[model samples]
Target: MSDTHAIAFVRNEMLPQAEPPVTQRGLVKWLRENMFSTIPNTIMTLLSLYVIYVLLASVVPWLFNGVWSGDSIRDCRAALDGATGGCFAVIRERWPQLLFGSYPSNLLIRPTMAFFLLLLAAAPVLFSELPRRLLWFTALYPFLAYWLIWGGSIWVPLFTIATILLSWLVFRALESRSFFGAIVAALIVFVVVSIVLGGPVVALLDSIATIRLQPVESRSIGGFLLNFILGTTCLSLSLPLGIALALGRKSDLPFIKGLCVIIIEFVRGVPLITLLFVASVMLGFFLPGGVDFDLIIRVIIMITLFASAYIAEAIRGGLAALPKGQYEAADALGLDYWQAMRLIILPQALKISIPSIVNIALGLFKDTTLVSIISMADILGMTRQRIMNTSEWFGVYWELLGFAALLFFIVCYSISQYSQYLERKLATDHR
Candidate 1:
């Protein structure tokens, strides 16, 4: 018993790495686990492969035989000798029109430059790793973009910028006294400044208007440029407005909640096409006879309103999904309503709502093609009217339409990918 009592405990060193079993590694393992795991899965995989083969058999030859250079559809047809091949010549010849619509060729550089600058302006906002100072340029971008695309006297944006700065300064100076007072003071300062400067600014602008780029009319805006303008402007405008609407709908005050409810319901109830129709036709009756609203501006207003309504509902769902404890915690911390909402509620709510918001944005971007119904020449409109309708390119549908689809897909896909990145960046659960 004494000898047996001194039993030794066994110890083992860390094991060396070993190759995984052949059936549990690499492409073979993946295929077995995911594609051929069962009888039904194998059948589906084989069927899918056959479908892909059929699609490639048809599309590959059509793509490879595509006529990239030809004067007209007739030239393409003659080259192909009755074989099924895409007449992509229409896209090659009419690319400029498809991009800028009727925008003056000599002035194309303005929009082109603005487009690149948009990427710059968006960089910091999209990627937090970028220096925060870049947001200054982001703030200036709308005005810069307006000047670049619409081509107006520089003084107009300058005056607008000055007014904003003045209002902000006023608000900051008075904020310590009272928030509502500061807001009122800011508004008063803005209105008074506008009244005092508006006349002189207009006169000065008139004197130097000749120095600016030749003003492009809204009617001249078409092609994908029009879609970009509408999508970007409406998307930007809708977000803040949607946030305000969402908050208003959730407010304790009955009147605010009721008003937001009515607006959201009314806008959501109507078809977007109906709203476009109203913007194109019926909206004029409501405006003063002397007031001339630009068609693009009118469309923007309608689209923004429509998108904001849907976005409000999405945000409301986010707010509803929030745990009651979050609200109680904010309250327990002695945070004010706006403070709680801004710092705690909104960050979490918006994070949850990102996917929905991105979906709305994608829908809004694609819906911009519907501007064609109002006789605006967005990408689809340009393809249908300016390209395909031409005698030389008639019946070259697949090529032009395919190009439009590809363009939309690229933009939408980029937005989708960015949204995913944003979700990961904002993730708090650390998954």
Candidate 2:
């Protein structure tokens, strides 16, 4: 019955002959280990508890108050007891304007269809059981999406059909190992058929119509959707231009190098809005005297140039950060400069600078808001106008501003988080 017996019992059973305690499996143990493991943690926990209680004391009641039960705005103002709740009926009524702007009574279908198309296109990535055709679908999905959004001609369908047939023929030819020859043959056939279909370039040129750009007509196309267009178009246009500029900056030719530097520096020095103004006014002067210019198109051109200058600098940093040994190694492998860049340098450099690119894109997203000052009716413009009519004007500002801030934060933060994850994964692979 003494220590000797206890020792013998423990050795014999590999246990204490009974469970220690049930409290070890419950909230007590979790609290002890997780929330109060150290003195600093326990202090912080108590502080957080106090802050939460104060916040809940103020927030929870107002959130469930009669104010939130509004069916119409009149019901909302009636129930307004200086509470902290939202009148969601306002959101319900104006939701269409918020989402689609003044897109057109019938054309609302177009944006909705675009949304569904995007989700449909992305569905395969989320559900792996989807058909392998999804991979090929992405290659032409953008064109398909644009076609659905903007209803084009019969020629568009014909082009799509021809593209599909050409793809199949190329795959068939390459599956038999005539890849290089097939590619060359395909190019020749494509060029010859294009010429036959449209006649000579000169003939087509003669058939083209010249138009004049009117400023007021161009400015009419500004809205929430335009901001998104600007962002995406800027990214698409700038990325290619950036890559070219990066190459040119690193070029051996004095002329090319100097030109790239001047272009990059000049764009970087100017504010984006100034560039937009210049585009709205001065871009037309550079073109032929009678040629028409669209304000949105000119803004896009300026944005493309502006974003490209920054992008070029970012890519140049990536290029410079690469080890000189990479260039030498590419040369040693008998790769031409373009091959080395395309196959080796650029992929790694871009991967390394994905975080930087994402940051630049986030900046561009913010810069897009400036388009409102230039007369675009983006989300901010909608918010400013919406807040004025609200009865709860004092609190409405916070709610509307918070919504806008949240959208920006979520998009930018997600990009940053994803880039970090990619960076970590790449680091793991390198190791």
Candidate 3:
């Protein structure tokens, strides 16, 4: 009787899980969670939809009804026949001027090739998974791009490259003893080599001048090409300069820190336009007589200085955000000042500052439009002065401005997307 009472337990088995409800799955779930999850959100969603609809209603007709084939705004208006439309014919007729400015039609291939090659050169640096060997091309790219865009004697870039390589060799040979001494030695070696070889190099290149592309004057460089040249050059230059400034600001030496502080504060206090104006007009006054500086070079220098100041502040914030434990750990490992900074501190600080750096880069790229104020024929200048002001395309503002905006958006958006990717790739918290 007792055994029978104890033997009444039931067998147990695991139950299979059911699929989520349809309303909690797929696109409907996403919209419910993100767009219409609450009363306020629902109202905002509707308002946003209305705004989008209004924009499309106005812009779609203007875009689709655009006259792609026309000689003038009159032809475009006649084609539209009192309907809303855009005169894209200005873009069609003056596309070359927009892209290359006064760049020779025969030499268009050079810049075209250089532009595509830039994508290749930038790939490895932007994406870490790419082979390190690709960085050789990246290193060679500046000289290649200069030759392509400026169409100078090929020997000039070659000599520059040779000097750089030789200087690097000298630096490496001396770096084990002293970093500062190595740098000084490298500079001396570079100067000596350049001077000794400059004449013979030019003479040799002159003999082969028939094989080279015709040299394009710096003044002939304009349009979007000029903007791109300035943006890329300044962006590349400013990063290292900014890093140096940030580190200098944190240095133990009073002189170094004071100099960095003064530079950053002074530059940050002044508006970028003021600096640009000074570069365009005032900088020449400071130079010796008979020394003529190129306008584009002056602009590049000014933009780089401006960008570096902002970027230095961003980097300094990153450095400050770092935990004391990191520095302690680096010191515990018996690392020297430069080694600790280079290997431990910078990698993490720069990673943290990626977004800020990208912001500075985007702003710098757009600021290239400011070159127009100096009477330089950047894309904005070309569009405003050459394209819109012309009798044939007069009063066609929206299409040309919109096209410029689209181009800038494409480039800026690409930079933003790349920064996001880099952030994800470098994330190590396992979150």
lDDT of 2 at 135: 63
Candidate 2 lDDT over residue span 61-149, tens digit each: 64565343444555676677565566655555555555545555465676577667766775674356689788677555666655554
Candidate 1, which ten residues in sequence have the lowest lDDT sum?
422-431
If the candidates were sorted by their lDDT against the true structure, best first, what order would they fall in?
A: 3, 1, 2
Which candidate ranks first by lDDT, i.e. highest?
3
The list of candidate 3 runs beyond 4 A from truth reads 1-46, 188-201, 204-211, 428-431
lDDT of model 1 at position 1:
67
Name the Cα RMSD for model 2. 7.7
TM-score of 3: 0.89
- What is the C-alpha local distance difference test score of each model? 0.91, 0.68, 0.91
The top-ranked prediction according to TM-score is 1
TM-score winner between candidates 2 and 3:
3
Backbone clash tally (model 2): 3
TM-scores for all candidates: the values are: 0.90, 0.69, 0.89
Q: Is candidate 1 or candidate 3 better by TM-score?
A: 1
Q: What are the per-residue Cα lDDT tens digits for candidate 3 across 1-431?
A: 67888887676976789989999999999999999999999999999999999999999999998899999999998999999988898889888999899999899999999999999999999887899999999999999999998886777888799889999999999999998689889999998988788778777877977346689998888899999999999999999999999999999999989999999999999999999999988999999987777889999999999999999999999899899999999999999888999999998899889989999999999999999998999999999888888889989999888888999999999999988888888882332
Evaluated at residue 412, the lDDT of candidate 1 is 99
Ranking by TM-score: 1, 3, 2
- In the predicted model 1, the residue pairs found to clash are none
Worst lDDT run of 10 residues, candidate 3, spans 422-431
